[model samples]
Target: MYETFDDTLLSRLNEPVPRYTSYPTAPVWESTTPEVYERHLSQIAKRSNPLSLYVHIPFCKTMCLFCGCSVILNRRPENEETYVNYLCKEIELVSAAIGGRAPICQLHFGGGTPTKLTQDQLERIFFKIVSAFPLDAHAEIAMEIDPRTVVEDEGAKLKLLKKLGFTRVSFGVQDTNAWVQEAIKRRQSLEVTQKTFRLAQSLEFQGINLDLIYGLPFQTVATFRETVHAILEMRPDRIALFSYAKIPWLKPHQKAIKEETLPSTHEKFGMYLAARKLLLGAGYVAIGMDHFALPGDELVEAFKAKTLRRNFQGYTVLPADDLIGLGITSIGSVGDGYFQNVKELSTYYQLLDEGKLATFRGKILSPDDLLRQWVIQRLMCDFAVDKAQFQLKFGTSFDGYFHQERERLKPLIDLGLVSVDPVSVRATALGILFIRNISACFDRYFHKKEGPRQFSKAI
Candidate 1:
């Protein structure tokens, strides 16, 4: 079983670390032209496995002060209509670059608030996706929604979304406490969130995920415990409890929040521990970092079968590797490399209007990178890795290559957060609490560089 770190150890380990969404995180990406992405896609089209698609909808009615995602303050219908049309064009451009329709096994729509679009706007985009790609018969279609946006006509909108092929939906219910919500500027009542969830359940959605943030302005262990109890009462199929990254430095809007109002590190840790105990008591299996799923959930099954995967969207049950990102500030992977679209809407539109792909910069995976990525993903997903499997895949002695890194991890191993031997590296029960620190052991970038903060809190 995993164990907790002492206060001294916890304080020392709480620092910035990459989420490891990708091997070479976005910060390392360099300028990548449309032609390079085009060539990469051409190679990907020859692969046997199908692809995954990620559509970014960077629009929101009201900005949340704690958000770090690229987004526009959109409330106008005409602006949404215009963005929807461009999304279609971007899809077409990507479809062409791949030379034709490719098998897509997973499709996800992520954003500031994907539900902000009108039913008509959503329909138009769904039509484009239907026409552009050949989706596998059992493909996973997921979307992220804001609870405040669709309270007007819940059943009609959800029913329409179901008809359009959405099997999964996540509602952003960061906190149910009114003061906590007010502090973040995303003030949705608990009743509204329950209504949306109940509607989705009645429509028979395959899965429901409730998004919760633990570390935020004015959150206490007792209050968050109440929030967890309410969430458990709803019984969402999955839960993503994230630590709020107060990155006002990167996302300037976050500056509006008073730093003093945020919970202290010790208090925030208590919230996490309490929430985990309650969820486990409610019969949810913790899946990777910041995620939990009930038994029989695909995510839990994927973990058991060792088929789980990590991507820009966090943990995914689908094992599809090639992702085609469509829309502004979107990112995708092709032929072992990652490419990103421009973040600004004006630039994104300018490129797409000229019949160009909106790739900004990218990086191809190096052999060493691939090996390290596999090791990292394995540890992150499975909490352990077999040395034999490592050797079989990479044709190198795992210990021989990562000897220095293995040595560097001795402190964590001694602290009882992780156990490493000649055969395997495993995170104990409480060790999983500091899994990011364990995984960071294999990240070469952090070791190679000095004095730079490009990531969020490890907790």
Candidate 2:
């Protein structure tokens, strides 16, 4: 069902590309102030669309060697308590800016490990947001769990979360192999992983997800196959098989990993293919580039219905018209603009103390940006672009407007990775594996002059 690849082809096609989580991408965002963000929120206040909220809990107990996200390592509970207080203040500032009591359809807690907070801290943040924004009756509440953090009182903690309206949770179990886990400095055993999964299942959470990484140090097809088989036994509602993005220049912590121990591109592809085959055989449907969901899952249904969306959090089924981000280093998208909070905790607290939002940088999408974002998001999510629909929406000829992009796609089409016709431009099953590169053709900001240091490889 897919094309075979030789080493030469694989090497040539393995160029770095943006994950396209955002259209213009974070690299192009310009410095801006809270004033600019407030202007955007003013515009949002006039619209009736429900908002999606993202809270970045940046505190973690320890550093995972392979992690590239923004996080702070603190052993003190007081630091977390202080951060939670500031988080609530920021929420109040944003709600006041939006004229108060904006409706919310989805709320996601992410970061270094949201569960790292004490139960009191967690409840405070949750109630503060719900009080500021009236949560819809059908809204989704979710968080990221670092299984080890909850191993002490797993059942009680999970039950507490469920009681507080947490319907979905994702556990970070990067790999189950002992050697690989040791190499990554995350040493949870298969038994612990299984116990955590069973605990969430027994808690009757509506959705449970596990995260896995391929191409890490010392991974082989046989080894990853064993991990995948072990994961299959749990049968989570969703699985995220991410490629190990080794950009040491961007994240210096990654340099701790030995280069020679990491799998080569060809070997990495082998591991991915083996794992994907097993997932498909076990009745999972691939959603977007790195996510897979069971057939009846909302993600699979969204993919089938062409309503799937991609955000900074990766693939998602709930597409909110506006997303409001709170806490340090959080990013938000309102209308045609995107904004981010200050990355430093001190600065975040200083701004909140001044009764201001901590927006540090942002980008207001130009008309060209909006159009290109639409095309790029469609290709990333649906794996195809309907030429007729583009014309209808943008009032232009897709062929004429994207002449250069279509030319850029010619080589991929010739290799049977892409197919184009008068009606639509689509990626074949083989092309889906390289969807990031395919979608990159439409990105106006991605340039050879800028270099590819900012992004990871498509594979």
Query: Model 2 off-target regions past 4 Å?
Result: 1-3, 448-452
Per residue, candidate 1 scores C-alpha lDDT tens digits across 70-127 of: 8899778888888898889988888877866458899999997788888888888988
lDDT of each: 0.87, 0.90
Window of ten residues with lowest summed lDDT in model 1: 1-10
Q: Candidate 2: worst 10 consecutive residues by lDDT?
A: 444-453
Per-candidate RMSD vs. true structure?
A: 1.5, 1.3
Relative to the unseen true structure, what is the Cα RMSD of model 1? 1.5
Q: In candidate 2, what are the lDDT values of residues 373-406, reduced to their tens digit?
A: 9998999999999999999999999999999998
- Per-residue lDDT for 53 in model 1? 93
Can you give the TM-score per candidate against the true fold? 0.97, 0.98
